[model samples]
Target: MSEPVSALQGAIFEGLVKVEEAGPCGMITLRGDLASTQVKTAATGVAGVDFPGQGEANCAGDKGLCWMSPDEILVLCPYDQAGAGVAAIDKLLAGTHYLATNVSDARARFVVSGLDAREVLAKLTPADMSPAGFAPGRFRRTRLAQVPAAFWMRDEHMFEVICFRSVAQYVFDILTAAATPGSEVGFF
Candidate 1:
């Protein structure tokens, strides 16, 4: 079997906050009728989290489900467990017109954390990183500088961002620049 590798092998850069490729995160893209109880069950059951509403993520430490669309969710788990996670979903939703795909290798994940995480990210995206506008559990699919990315707050002081593996370096560089010390934007 091919061993898994993180996009940056957990590269860390300290600045206003901390930016690092956390690790290889397991991701499964499941497309189905979101309103269906069977699909909801499969998603939440796999993530050990509640079903999230639109533009929301129900995650704890990078493991849970992010609402991708009205008919899609991204299941998060340990990198090594993604294949098994897909099998579980397939078995759970058999004959239910659902599609569950392991997408772990297609993306990279990072932890943008610390007291200044919000300001650091706010400098890059158009999203309202202000506390009142983007609270915890809220998930947004938006661009970071130029590349498409998704992010959510694990809490008030921590955020998780994910983007295509092909642009991992770009994302990392942009994030680090946005967070470079002595360059703090006290916008938040």
Candidate 2:
């Protein structure tokens, strides 16, 4: 099968905020008991990073593990490593009631940065975008423009947002419009 291209290839645009496709990434959804030592150990071993605490994300090298819920996590790695990542995770959790599936193709990631990145997002989601509330390494499963989405800060100036592939185009367009000059939706 031909590798799927980014939903917005070379279609970056900037206004108050800079928006760009994060490119293809490997996303594996892991559903298991986080309280189990074996499960945690197996997840870390396969992800090359420790599982993040609730609402947090931990990155080691190119791998990032985001805590989705008490019993779920999303592992992010190089696109090419998705299959192996899933297989390794499965093997590690052998004999356990676990479900590990690659969801890379189902999601699209975008990076929103620049001085107004947070401001742009504030217009879309109810999430607290202030530094005091939603600091770096923190993540939230929220809606953007009424579309289900999730995002985490890479730092003070950058954030990565992921949404369903089917709505990637709509999300991108909404963000760009929000980031456009004179479209400021003041902070809450």
- Off-target runs (Cα >4 Å) in candidate 2 are 185-188
Q: Return the top candidate by lDDT.
A: 1
Displacement of the residue 154 alpha carbon in candidate 2, Å: 0.3
Error of 2 at 112 (Å): 0.4
Candidate 1 C-alpha error for residue 48, in Å: 0.9
> What is the lDDT, from 0 to 100, of the residue 137 in candidate 1?
86
- Candidates' C-alpha lDDT: 0.91, 0.86
Candidate 1 per-residue lDDT, tens place, 46-111, comes to 899999999999997658999888889999998888889899989999888989999999999999
TM per candidate: 0.96, 0.94
Candidate 1 — worst ten consecutive residues by lDDT sum? 60-69
